[model samples]
Target: MEVFEKINYLISEKNLSKKEFADKFLSLNPRLRTTGEAPSYSSIYGYLSGRREIKIELIPYIAEALNVKEQELFNFDLEYSTEFNIRYSKDAREIIELLQYAPKNMIEHIKATLQKFKKSYEDGVKEPTSS
Candidate 1:
């Protein structure tokens, strides 16, 4: 798949609209645009429509905003990609460890945190201050 199609698929998988994705992208990389100004919605639209290309420099930022690794936005066969295994191995191990030793209360806390953050994210509210 082309980069544009991959990006669209990832965005859809995350259930984020173009505007929401762009907003998150800008939030994660404030320097994507001028200071105190959000990125133009039209730019995002253009990329999604394949009228414009996403800058290569922004790929990492976009991937991070979408909660994925940078390579996931490209067309690569995972089964043959050693880099994919190397990149995700640590994260997969950490997730396994978390599942093994995480107490029920701690699991609940993590779930609640994710739920609260998802709600706040959708509502455009500031993330609640973490203690």
Candidate 2:
């Protein structure tokens, strides 16, 4: 996906309006907040509206502000076409990588555990309060 498209996706996923996203992005980043080149009101509008190119250097700041990886803004496909996209958090990505090397039996065990967790959450099973 294009940079703007990814930005839009994040904006929607995080339940933030365009202006709010821009405000938060500007406020959270100290370096960019002070610099004139920061993604200010006008610049953010330009980026989202496809009137300006979001500079490559700004990708990291954008990702950090949104709590995502910088690669998500780029159009590169990490794996082949048949694979699921790696759009997960850093911890999830690490788990995915670790699972790739896990034994088949261990993978099955993990899957079963995950399924149980999913079912539990889906069924509204709350955790016990800690003593």
Candidate 3:
């Protein structure tokens, strides 16, 4: 999906209306217009509708409005996500490379071990308590 589509999906996922999204975006004061003011509500609607391109400068404000990281807007596909992780995370890259050479049985055993680790970590997590 395109960036606008991703934004729309995130808005719906967050249970926000277009108006609410526009309100939040405006409240962030993106200030991308030539006049150094936040874009008008109709302009925000245009961005949502793909009638206008989302300015690069507004990405942070848009992300803040949506309560998401800026990369979340662009990371629409698994290929991009995997490439990003592999580029930035040595451990992730090594794990993927190692998995490629692992036998099926070994992979299954690894999965089980990872699942146990995850469960143990989750079990150890304590919920925050009110003072």
Candidate 4:
């Protein structure tokens, strides 16, 4: 989904009107443009209506007003796919979401840690239990 679509989806999910979002967005007091002024309500409304492109600089404030991480603005998968019929705990889900925005180096470290856990599990499985 495009950024605007994602924003609209989030707005609906949050049960907020476009006007309410615009007001909350301004309440955050984000300064942009050469004039160092916050965008006007009409400008924000234009962005929501897809009449104006959202500025890249406004993403942080927008995300904050939407009560989501900045990366969430670009994430199309608002709901997890049920194709696998797999379910995880809320904490696990949170970890997965956080991993989406984690730095590459951190991901590499996590991969190494997971490999170690996998190896340990495999080794334990290979060992016969004593009666």
Residue-level lDDT of model 4, residues 9-122, one tens digit each, is 778877899989988999999888766999998889888878899999999999999999899888655244442222332345479869989999999998887777667667
Off by over 4 Å in 3: 78-131
TM-score of predicted model 3? 0.60
lDDT of 2 at 120: 73
Alpha carbon lDDT of each predicted model = 0.71, 0.69, 0.78, 0.79
Q: Please provide, for model 3 over 1-131, each residue's C-alpha lDDT reduced to its tens digit, 9 standing for 90 to 100.
A: 78998888778767899999998888876786567878988888999999999888999999999987898788765433633442343355358768989999999988887677667657884332222
Model 1 lDDT on a 0 to 1 scale: 0.71
Off by over 4 Å in 2: 30-37, 75-106, 109-131
Error of 1 at 93 (Å): 15
Clashing pairs in 1: none
Candidate 1: C-alpha RMSD after superposition: 14.9
TM-score of each: 0.51, 0.55, 0.60, 0.59
Alpha-carbon deviation at 5 in model 3, angstroms: 0.4
Q: After the best TM-score superposition of candidate 4, give how far the Cα of residue 49 lies from its true spot, in angstroms.
A: 1.4
Q: Residue 23 CA error for candidate 2 (Å)?
A: 1.2
Best by lDDT: 4
